[model samples]
Target: MSGEFHLSVVIPNRNRAHSLARAVLSVRDDDAGAEIIVVDDCSDEDLSAEYSQLQAMGVRVLQQDSRRRGGAARNRGVREAGGTHVSFLDSDDVWLPGRHDRIRRFYAAPGRDRTVLVSGALLHIDGDIRRPHQPDWRPGRSLVEYCYRDGGRVQTSMLSLPAGIARAHPFDEDLRVNQDTDLAMRMDRAGIAFHIDPEPGVTKEESPRPDRLTTGAETADLSFAWYRRESGDWSPAARSGYFLQDRVWRLADSGRRPAAFAALARSLVPPVSPRETARRALSMIAGEGLYSRLRAGWRQRAPAPADPGLIAAGERWRDLDARARAFCATARDAAAGQPGTIQ
Candidate 1:
């Protein structure tokens, strides 16, 4: 909230009018003074009336004439942002309570100027399953290693960084998948500092829309291409781990067994994590469905989080969800007579 650390929240949306209001309202509730920008990526449906309602709420809605995807939309939002720092929220995601305060405290601390990015844990909701995605980053680990080797993740909604840095190091517009990983790897290679907050600050809903980019049939190939492109400078351990753990599964799931087997073979040229490689090889052999079921069973046997802090955060998320639904209902009513009422 201070002049030295005003936050700007940029949300990239495309035909998600039904969920856009919730994302906007989350930011409005979390940080009243923060700038909110929603960049529409040329949805097929006309959203002028919905945009108008959002505009009335003081949200800046930028409608693009052409579809450039979420990465480009985020880049444009950062370029247009007027705040000192920026955070991103996907149209389907919402921030948890105390997100604003956590960001403010992080930036206000001394020696934080060197920090180019900060991300916190996320409460990932996948249908009936809910899990916490904690940051796996440490001082000496590369982002790729943290992601592939350690099974870590940092979604766009969990990210916050200075506006200048975001402008200087823009997201890869060419990437339809792995954009978050691509940007984080670039930042890590640049030698800038990154901070990982342990607490969950975002509630990310994994939408099951078949039209979603991540669920596209080409997602496996695209992700593999991204790995090949970015892993050039990565250490052998990171490269091998990525192939064995991430690419192998994706390729297998996409019914690209030949490519998956080929990747598995390549991961062995300079063997790393032999156990993991063997496990993945078995998973690939077992087929995607069986592998998924086995993995789900293993997770079921694993203990659930009993942390008091996490429980409190879960309660807050439920409260936020209720409020977001109420806000959405109000928004829909306000736009009832309009051409597009965010149905």
Candidate 2:
């Protein structure tokens, strides 16, 4: 078993015990040979039973004293992992059956770049799976280039970078939101190529309840400090973030718009390098157009009746369902000619 373990699945989980159980169960059911590590980030709820269950299935549980953010937790797990390749799974997301097997196969494929990170599909699911307004990825393109050309939304859950790359470019713990995007972009900058499988490899859970959206935004805003720190570098990821910040401003209400605008204004400042400045400008423009279209399409989709289970879940765990719903509603109204009212 030790000799055969070629991949390590690192899952950083906080207080979401139930969701964590489901995610780990998905891996256990797949019977994948990868070593599983669940890093507990000072969760208030005791997850001893879940730990025992995972251990029974050959998972290693690492407990951390401080509640470092998820990126930091993932970094800690990678340090403790023992595999040739490393894959990340968010606590709320699930790997479809055979995801690990498929990823390993991609790695083993002839003519594939061993140094290149491989990723595939990520279908967003709330109560039920719904198609994203925009394609998560394009077919047969360099994942790194795709991220560079567009804004980085590469699903880290479906990504498997070589052990060396993961060691060299761990997730930026300083970022609370958009950290995955930042990490992916950094990997690309570090010269890691990427291959994306055309099939769905993971499920990203989306919740559309009101309070949930605000919380998501708040948590997302926490990463702005990190963004400010990296503002000197106008990488594709940073440009993507700039467009994202502008959209955030567009969605901002009367009071928040000032702050949002201030952030966007800051992004206009050029990075020191000429190449970086040009890349940043291109990324901002590209991300803006893409973000606009996607938001428009989301508004076009018919809103389903609010799911009570989702709302209840939002209530219990400060889920993003409400916020997602609100965003959808605004999009819908905007699609129908009523300008979206920012919250």
Best by the TM-score measure: 1
lDDT of 2: 0.60
**Clash tally, candidates in order:** 0, 11
Put down candidate 1 lDDT per residue, 65-127, tens digits, no spaces: 689999999999999999888999998876777889888888888777657555565554443
**TM-scores, one per candidate:** 0.82, 0.65
Per lDDT, the best of the predicted structures is: 1
The TM-score obtained by model 1 is 0.82
Worst 10 residues of 2 by lDDT: 334-343
Residue 281: error of model 1 in Å? 6.6
TM-score of structure candidate 2: 0.65
Q: Model 2: per-residue lDDT, tens digit, 138-198?
A: 5454443354334334766867876767878888776667677678767666666666565
Sum up the clashes in candidate 1.
0
